[model samples]
Target: MLKGKTALVTGSTSGIGLDMAEALAREGANIMLNGLGDATEIEATRAGLEKRTGVKVSFMGANLMKADACADLVAATQKEFGTLDILINNAGMQFVSPIEEFPVEKWDAIMALNLSAPFHTIRAALPAMKDAGWGRIINTGSAHSLVASPFKSAYVAAKHGLAGLTKTVALEAAEHGITCNTICPGYVSTELVDAQIADTAKARGMTEKEVIQKVILEAQPTREFVTVEQISGLAVFLCSDAAASMTGVILPIDGGWTAH
Candidate 1:
């Protein structure tokens, strides 16, 4: 359905971002992947996606924490593909600490990457999308965007801000045939979440199993993690003509976590 279209997926070297990039590629969209990883592994991922999907694939290790770098990533995509029809703002960071003890630097970094980077990229991508009269902007928000948990002040704040940014973009871009929406996902068993589980276990004086069952999955009434395929599937749908009217929606793929 996306033949000849180009998608830029940030933080796509692995995990949910990579899966969404691949899903878009398989549906006939050229892909630009951005993230940090071993050079060799990243190259392999890039080459493998191109081979498997028969779509042009490129990789850029743009540091998303910088506003200039975020704009440059969009520019690079336009240069490589001549256009960027879909923008997936998926790069983010998480830090857990009480508000009083949270490092100021960490808060700044989280806010930069999680909130400011998307603003820069969206601003840079909008003009061309407006010119083309069609575009899709999908932000990877979290359940935190709607609800908050303790010890996640910076992360929750950034995600909540992202939700607002997405809605504003949707409203501003609606008339141009451009759509902006956020995908709010709950827990996913990725490497980052794995580290979070271990850290919570140690901090809360619980075993890993206990943390998984009691701390992480406790709010997720389904007692399951959201899958990468499911998240990417919704992204594909949002890009389809069927979802053309679905702008400014915070569609949650959490396992009934927010339903509480």
Candidate 2:
């Protein structure tokens, strides 16, 4: 459905970002992936996706905490694909600690990556999208965006800021045929979450199963992690013509975590 278009997905070397990239590529969109990973591994992923989807795939690693790097990443995508039709700001970091005890540096890093990076990328990419008269901007937010979680002050604040940013961008770009929205997901099962579960289990003197059931999935009403494929599928739909009017929406795929 997206043949001849191009998408730039940040933090796409693995996990949810990689899944989104693959989904767009499978729909025939050329992909430019950005993230941190083993150089060899990233190349293998890039090559494999390109081969399987029969669409152009490329990778560019950027430290998104830096404003210049975020801008440069967008520029690189435009230069590579000649036009960037889709921009997915899926890069983010988390630091969990009491607000009083949170490291200043950690808070800054989270805000930079989770909030400011999208601003920089969208600023760089919007003109081209405006000129072309079409664009889709998707920001991967968390349930924390609409609610709160203890020991996650920085992450929560950044995500809330991202939600506001998405709405502002949507309003500004509405006349240019550009749509901006945030996808807020609940706890997702990924390598990072698995590692967290193990650490939490050890720290709290609980079994892994207990950690998964009580500590991790406690607040999620469905008691299940949101799947990467499900989030990717929603993203694909948001980019489709049928969703042309769905802008500035903070759609949650959080298994009812935010419904409370």
TM-score per model over all chains = 0.99, 0.96
Candidate 1 clashes between residue pairs 3 or more apart in a chain or in different chains = none
> Against the hidden true structure, what lDDT does model 1 obtain?
0.95
Whole-model lDDT per candidate: 0.95, 0.92
Candidate 2: list runs displaced more than 4 Å.
Answer: 198-208
TM-score between candidate 1 and the true structure? 0.99
Those runs of model 1 whose alpha carbons end farther than 4 Å from true positions after fitting are none
TM-score of 2: 0.96
lDDT per residue as tens, model 2, 120-142:
99999999999999999999998
lDDT of 2 at 220: 94
The residue-by-residue lDDT of candidate 1 on 110-134, one tens digit each, is 9999999999999999999999999
For every candidate in turn, the CA RMSD to the true structure comes to 0.7, 1.5
Quote the lDDT for 107 in model 2. 90
